[model samples]
Target: MSQPLSVPESHPRPALIVVMGVSGSGKSTVGAALAKAISRPFIDGDDLHPKSNVEKMSRGQPLTDEDRFPWLAIIRSTAERVCAEQAHSGEVKEGDRPAAVVVCSSLKKIYRDILRGQHAASTKMPAEEDTSEKHPSGAHLPASPALQTYFVFLDGTENLLMDRMSARKGHFMKASMLKSQLATLERPGEGEDGVARIDIDATPEEVEGAVRKAVKDMVGM
Candidate 1:
């Protein structure tokens, strides 16, 4: 166990946390736990996948980048919307932390960059700029604050991941596709911003604890 990270008197709002890993790495489970621990909402990236993509994966086929583009866009928009809602709600005070945890197999650097709002071609609204103010009509608009994105990569041995995937029921992904996912995975480098790596060998509770600590360290929480 690690020492608790200190929470500053004042810190930024709208912490967008992506719990990322290969399938069966416990991303959804750990993401839900982390969200509960941090008092944030959890969004499962699987729910955002298109029907075609789901059907293909169910047949044990791996998704191409083109198949994933729209799905990733949806996830990005969902996170942005959640953060915007938190900013509008009066629940967050000066020092209070507002966050959303999303579970996704963000295996590639380009995918992670899209989630971080760093992609120039992203269709999602800009995080820092308030487009609502620009509109003359007072229709409710989504306006996210400057996002502070964090990645919690749950890494594990191939055998463990395959075992877990085999135990899973009613999922579109097949255990046999684990190799493809591992091949696609691009571990965050030392210079990458706001990334934390956790060994999946730990119990779910312990993993969640580590995730919370890593997020706190990332956001000065």
Candidate 2:
């Protein structure tokens, strides 16, 4: 059975947590685990990508911003919906509480800005209105609160990343893409709010604990 999207708990405010990095950065695994641990919904940003996008990556073609724009829209809209719904329910009095964790590449600061802009626009609109249709798929998503976004940057040595990618099967992303991703990644700097970096060598449990603490600290949960 598919998991329900919005978390059931009474959140203080809606948060838009982005667990992001290159392909082998364990975004999906860590995102899902963290969500389960926190009792919040996890949205795999990769699954939101169109098949054509995956195909391009499988062919080792790096995606240009034009190609990635629509995919980012889908992810932003999904997170917006969760935040809007929770905020509208009146459970979260503050407008900045994060409602869910969205796993995405979020490679560049520009991409992060775009995601933030989308949510900011959504939150500014009236709750009864649906602005999500303006996005890529033109799908209607609920209005979200002022998003408290967090960035979890997963990093490791190039050799380690390649090994992880090489071992994986059935995925569209190839080990060959690792070098490109590593070269392209723009690591978040200290000034960025809610940013945390974890060495990929850490155990899954350890990573989860760090993420939980980060989320709790951000939301005061």
Candidate 3:
């Protein structure tokens, strides 16, 4: 195992992590592993998607932005609540700590902006479909916490993802929709913030190790 990254004393607040990528990219598995290593709560982004959306995907339909809007709202609200509540009370539930490790595809930059708004309302980040000329920070939410937000992008070739989807069983999403997902996928670029993009070329263990190391290094854990 690689050594954990050491956090700087001046860093503020626990990280709000989003394990993101297209379906079959192992967001849940890797996110859970990262949460375990960091000792934080893991909130699966899949759980936040509405039943209707799941049904549509299962039926091999690509979701329109309209279909994703409400689901994204729920994600943003939950994240906001998590950060704001902890910042207010400084106490975690039961034996848990204050940090949250959330896993969501967060495909579009606009989707991420919506989540950022939840962290601080003063930053009026654009809505998912609101891909106007304005940047994410252009709209500010002051109420949002200043805590660091980390995003992990699980990446692989289309063939690899398709093969994994075919091998997996009983998932709410169907293999038929894999192509649609691939078509809709938006890979992370260098300009995105708090993003740790991992290319999955080796074993799952290796991918998990890279993610763990990225988080530790990014957050100075």
Predicted model with the maximum lDDT: 1
User: What is the RMSD, in Å, between candidate 3 and the native fold over all Cα?
Assistant: 9.4
Which segments of model 3 are wrong by more than 4 Å? 1-11, 50-62, 84-97, 118-147
Model 2, C-alpha of 148: deviation from truth (Å): 2.4
C-alpha lDDT of all candidate models, in order: 0.71, 0.67, 0.66
For residue 119, give model 1's deviation from the true position in Å. Answer: 2.4
What are the per-residue Cα lDDT tens digits for candidate 3 across 106-206? 88776776555442333332454342222132112233344456788888888888778778877765766677677777776777778888988779899
lDDT at 137, model 2: 33
Q: Order the candidates by TM-score, highest first.
A: 1, 2, 3
- Model 1 lDDT per residue over 1-221, tens place: 11212223363556778999998988888889888877778998877665667789889786877767556665665666565556556445665676779999899998887677655354343344332432222212222335667899999999998878778877766755788788878989988888999998887778878877887787655
Report the Cα lDDT for residue 31, model 1: 88
Runs of candidate 1 with Cα error greater than 4 angstroms are: 1-11, 50-62, 122-145, 169-172
> Weakest 10 consecutive residues, lDDT, candidate 1?
134-143
Model 2 residue-pair collision total: 9
Which of the numbered candidates is closest to the native, going by highest TM-score?
1
